[model samples]
Target: MAGSSFDNLPLEWIRAFEAAARMGSFTAAAVETGLTQSAISQRIGHLERRLGTRLFVRQARSIALTVEGDAWLPHVRTALESLRESSEALFGVARDRLTISASTSVIDLWITPRLDRLTQAIGGQITFRTMVLSTDAPHDDDTVRIRYGTGDWPQTYKQPLFSEVMAPVAAPALLHKDEAWQDLPRIAVSGPRPGWTEWCALTGTPTVPIPVLRFDTFASALAAARAGRGVLLASLPLCAADLSSGTLARIGDATLPHHATYWLIASKERLSRTQWGALSGALTLR
Candidate 1:
C-alpha cells in the first residue's frame, strides 16, 4: 500500500514544529505551549520523520532551523493565522477582557486619567502591561499597544494618539513671579524626544543653563519637575492634566512640534471594526 501525502500530519506536530522553530529551543517552545521539553522534542521528531526531512539541527546547547524549515515557516504561520482568524470569525465567543501594552510614562500620564471614559467606551475589563523599555515589543496576547513612532507599522490598525508638542515646563514654586524660567536649573530626560538643545535652537536662544538633574525615563523627569527640581522639556499632551490642575506651568509661549509621537496600534485581525472604532475614538486627542 502507498502512503498518503497528508498521512501522519497532525496539528500538534505542526504546532510543535512552529513553536520550536520560532523560539529556537524545544524547552522554550514547551514552556510557551504548556508542554514538557521531552514532549515538544518528540512531537518535532515525529513531524520531521513524517515529512521525510530534518527541520532542526540540534546542538548540545541550542537548536537551529534547517534551510527547508526556514523556508516553510512563513507558509505555516500564514496557514495557522488563517485558521485562527477564520475560527474566530465564525464561532468565537465574544470576550470582554482586553489587554494593553505601553510604556510606564504613557500608562501613567495618559491612560490613567482616561480610564473611566475608556471603560465606558469599550464596556470591558482592561488589563495593562507596563513596558520598562521604549523598544519593548507587544506580546501576542496584547490586544492593543501604545507605541512611539511615525505610524508605519504593517498589518495593524494605527492612529496617532496625540500630536506631540514639547515645551519647557516647571513647578510654580521653582519660578519666582516675573522672573525668567530659562535661567533656572534644567531637568534633562534622555530619550528620542527633543531636548533643550533643539528647543533653544528653535526659539533662537543662544544657550541655556546646563542640566542639573538627568533621568532616563520621562516619568522620572516629570516627577522631578513636579517636585520643584528644575525646568523640564515636557510633552504638552502628556502633561495636560498637570498643566490644567496647576501642578506644572508652561515656561513660555514657545512650543516644538515633532513628526514622531505616540500611536495607538492593534493588529487588524485581532480586533473587530466596532471594537477598534470604540478603542481609537475613546483615546484619540480631540
Candidate 2:
C-alpha cells in the first residue's frame, strides 16, 4: 500500500490521544472525558490510522504506549499547553486590555475614586484593562504609568496633579477615650523617607519608639489601620474619602513632605485622540 487513505484527523483526535496516554486507561480517559469508552477508543483508532502509527498497546485491564507514542507525548503536551495559555490571553476572559501599572497604594486609595472621572474625561468609549505590577518604571506596552518620585521622569512629559499632605490615621475605636495619643503600632509604608520620623520632626512632638508594621503599599496599610490593627501614615488627600466617610480617622495633625509627589506620566508619542481628550479634561482646572 503506497498511500493509505485516512480521514482528516481533527484537534479532537489529538486531544483524545493525549488524554488517553496520560490516564493510561481508555475507560478512565472516557470517564474523565465524559465520553463512552468505545467513543474514546474510536477517536484514538481514527488518529492512529491517519498518522500511520501504533499509539498504544491494549491489555485486558490497562493500556501501554508504543515507543513512538512515549517519545511524542511530551511535545504534544507542550504544544497543547502553549495553545491553551495563548488562547486564554487573547480571549479577554482571563486577561485585560490597556494594562496600567501603578503602585498598589495609588490603585486602591487614589485611582479607585478618580477612575470614573478619568474614564469620563477620555473622549472615546473604550474601557481600559488595568493591572498592578510592583515596578516603579513602566516597561513596553504600558499606556499610562504613575510613579511617586520627584517630578523627573525619563522619556515622558510629567504633570504634577497635586501635593500630598501626610498624616497618621486610624480607626477611631482604637484611640482610647481617656489615654494620651502616643501608644500604637505605626503602619509604616516602605519608601525613601521614614514618614513617622519626618512627621514627628515637623510637629516638634516627642518622637516615641512606635513599633512599626511595614507594608509595601498605602492601600494594604490603610486596610490594616481601618480594621483597628494599627495606625497608618498616609497623605490626607489620597485618603480623603475614607477619612470623610469615617471609615478611618485622622489620629493627629502632624504632616510631612512626600519624597516624591504623585505624577501623571505618559509616553512622548502623540496622544491618541481618546487619550488627548482624557488628558486635557483631567488636567483642566475645575
Candidate 3:
C-alpha cells in the first residue's frame, strides 16, 4: 500500500489497531480506549481494510498478532513513550517542579539548609523525599538521588558532590578546653560506615574500647551527640549545622578523610546540563 493510503486512514483506526494488537482482544482495547467493544472491532476492521492485511488472527477467548502487527508493536510503543517524554520535558514537568531524593541526614543537614537558594536560582518549587539509604540503594528514575560512595555507580550519571570528612564532636559543656577527649564516651553509627576504629586509624589516635555506645541509625547517634551523651565521630555533611551553631563542638584537632564520599547520581537522559548545574550549585555553596 502507498504511504498516502496510510495518511487517508483515520488516526483513530490506527490507534484502535495498536491497542487491539497490544491487548490481544477487541474487548481489552475497548476498555483501554474507553469505547465499546463493537466500536473497537469496527475500527480495527477499518484499519485492516486500509492496510489490505490481517493484523491479528481472531480466535475464541484470545487473539494473536500477525507477523506484521508483532513487528509494528515496538515502533508504536516507542512513539508513545517519546511523545510523553518530549511533552513533559518541553512543558516543564508540572510547570518547573523538581523532585529530589536523598538520605534523611543529607536532606536534613545539607540540602534543606540551602533550599531557599535553590528555589531562587531555579525559579521553581522544589519537593524533597527522604530515605535512610546506603551507597547500595536502588537507583530511582523519578527523583535525583544523592548517595554516599565513590562516584562510580553503574547505570547513573554520577558526580562527586563532596569529599566527606569526619571529626569527633560533642556538647561543649562535656569537655574543657585542654581536657583530653581520648577517653571520653564514643558514639558510633552501626550503618554502612567506617567506625571510630577507622577514624582513629586515619587521625593517628590509638583506639580505645571503653564506654562505646552504638546506634543502629545516624539520627539516633546524632540525637545522642546533641544531648551531650558522648562525642560523636560524625561526617561533616551530617552534622554541618550542629558544627556551625556550636551546639556540637569538635573535641579534638583531628579531622580525618571519610571512606565514603557524597555523590549526586541521576539519569543523564532525564536531565540537561543547565538543570543539573542549577541544582548542584544550590546544594553546595561552593
What lDDT does the true structure give each of the candidates? 0.86, 0.70, 0.76
| lDDT measured at residue 67 in model 2 versus the true structure, 0 to 100 | 97
Model 1 clash tally?
Answer: 0
Ranking by TM-score: 1, 3, 2
As for candidate 3, its clashing pairs are: none
Report the number of the highest-TM-score candidate.
1
- Model 3, range 1-286, lDDT digits (tens) per residue? 4587567568688788888877778998999789999999898888888777888888888889999878877887787667655765677443287777777777777777787887886787677877656646564545577776767665335676677877888988877646578877878887766778877778777688544788876777898989888888888767878888989888667777766777777765566555777777777674
For candidate 2, write residues 63-88 as lDDT tens digits.
99999999989988998878765664
lDDT of 1 by residue, 1-286 (tens): 3677457589999999999988889999999889999999999998888888999999999999999999989999999888876876687665599898888898898888888889988787899998754675547888888888788776458989999999989999888756677678899988889988998889986566899899988889999999999899999999998899999999778899999999998886578756788888888845
The deviation in Å at residue 30 for candidate 3 is 36
Per-residue error at 273 for model 1, in Å?
Answer: 1.0
Q: Show how many residue pairs clash in every candidate, following the order shown.
A: 0, 0, 0
Worst 10 residues of 3 by lDDT: 134-143
Candidate 3 error regions (>4 Å): 1-95, 135-141, 177-179
